[model samples]
Target: MKAPFFLFSIVLLSILSSCGSNKELQERAPAQFNEVYYSQTENGLNLYIPVAVIQENRVKLESVYFRGMHSALNLDAEKPNLYVASFATGKGDKIMHEDPKEEYGNKAPQAPKESPFKIESDEAILVFKQNEKTKYYKLTGIEERN
Candidate 1:
């Protein structure tokens, strides 16, 4: 019937659209990321990436996905060709204000399942825009500095 055909078409479209093209995302980024590093400060973890944009088109660095968290990158005012992202590493003390009845109705939430494309601990996925298209570049073997 027409209804069944329509449902099948929708399902097919969904699957196709969900698939991303990673041909441009090489194993390593094209830019010069030789000094990409991170440091753990009292406030949080500060990531520093010194990039040399070589593409003809201007590359807009979007965000960094690291350690299961996504953070927006910002250009440092004092440094050129450098992008930085910060992650809060400290957790504040919990306040003693809660209601057992309102807390999930006495049922604890289920544990979160692992994502299919979970990022590695020592690697980061940089989401950027070039030529008006969004792209991802993986930077591996990141080192930590004191």
Candidate 2:
């Protein structure tokens, strides 16, 4: 009985110590993108990307739109064409119309009418064609303002 109890105590202690180490690792981990973009539109599409995600070549967009429309958009690292994706409106997230998935059915989803740009760096860039000329808008991290 004493031997079993001693072994159980040792295992429990090891498990507890490992758990504490994991928490410390998470807390000390460096952020991928120090700053995030805040949506000025009604959809409230704010995206946060960590440095690790970018390094891993996997981009994840987090957003919070109204009742309708999709708030999240992901660009897989394996697919390069997806990087130069389009959007519904030239304006901000608020102007976006209904989600293509709901309208055309998930089977035949429509591409966004407007192609934003191919995200390849820390900054998010939006390219627009104005008066037969191309314009660029570089999105900076919101935290940088502070």
Candidate 3:
């Protein structure tokens, strides 16, 4: 009787512990890294991204897509089906590194630039970032697979 009860208690404890083990917050890598998606419809576009590339004190998500030119055109919920696109971005999350300055500490980095208007797809993650002298980011195009 004692042996049976001990075994049952151990099993139950193990089960309970495993349930909430992952519930606690933990530093997790970008869940959307290297992920991409695409869509092209009537007067519409879509691009799913889940990556990060910090440059010039800006996060400039590698996985998130931005719209418009240098003008910070805030995309609305209707802008792109973020829900269907996979991972999305928020204003506060422009970059995802601890220090913005450290990201571009490599050398006399060129100025920021923008990608020309010529995205030939619905779902796309194309961006252009410019800086002081030359074009820092010419065209960071991101294409989704399947």
Candidate 4:
């Protein structure tokens, strides 16, 4: 009787708590971009986001979160309203593999360390600061260029 009622109350509370925390998803981002694309270079990957407009001047772009990594973003001085992020390739993964002594002395691999390089993919997350508040915006439909 009471046990089942308490279990149901706990489940209901958890669902409500999770739903209340995602307020940002319900709000719209106040910026616009002309296009978002990525190009592969010999050095690495270059992401180009041409800004059509930002809702306010106080909005400062911090970094671009893609795949599972975050890369710094900066405005291009040569091009107007263009924000770019460059990620170097050829870097090895974050996993660390220990060398085996004699042939069979290898233990389990160590936990992975987060990589500094960004992941090249179609979807990106734009992290920015507006009015001293940090927020995130999802950017999809990113085109790949040669």
Q: Count the backbone clashes (under 3 Å) in each candidate.
A: 0, 5, 21, 0
TM-score to native of every candidate shown? 0.66, 0.28, 0.24, 0.61
lDDT, candidate 1, 1-146, per-residue tens: 99999999999988887775333554646466657889886556778888766563666788877776667899899987888988765532333337754544232222333322556788888887777777778887899999
Task: Return the number of clashes found in candidate 1.
Answer: 0
Winner by lDDT between candidate 4 and candidate 3 = 4
Clashing pairs in 1: none
Candidate 1 Cα misplacement greater than 4 A, ranges: 1-24, 27-30, 91-116
What would the TM-score be for candidate 2 when compared with the true structure? 0.28
RMSD to true structure for each model, in Å: 7.3, 15.1, 18.7, 8.5
Q: How accurate locally is residue 11 in candidate 4, as Cα lDDT from 0 to 100?
A: 100
Model 4 over residues 1-104: C-alpha lDDT tens digits?
99999999999999999975643521566478887998876556788989888866788888876655557998899997899987665342333446434445
Model 3 per-residue lDDT at 116: 42
- Tell me the lDDT of model 3 at 90: 23
Prediction 2 global C-alpha lDDT:
0.36
Q: What lDDT does candidate 1 reach at residue 64?
A: 79
lDDT of each: 0.71, 0.36, 0.37, 0.71
lDDT (10s digit) by residue, model 3, range 3-55: 99999999999999997553221133222345445444322344544344324
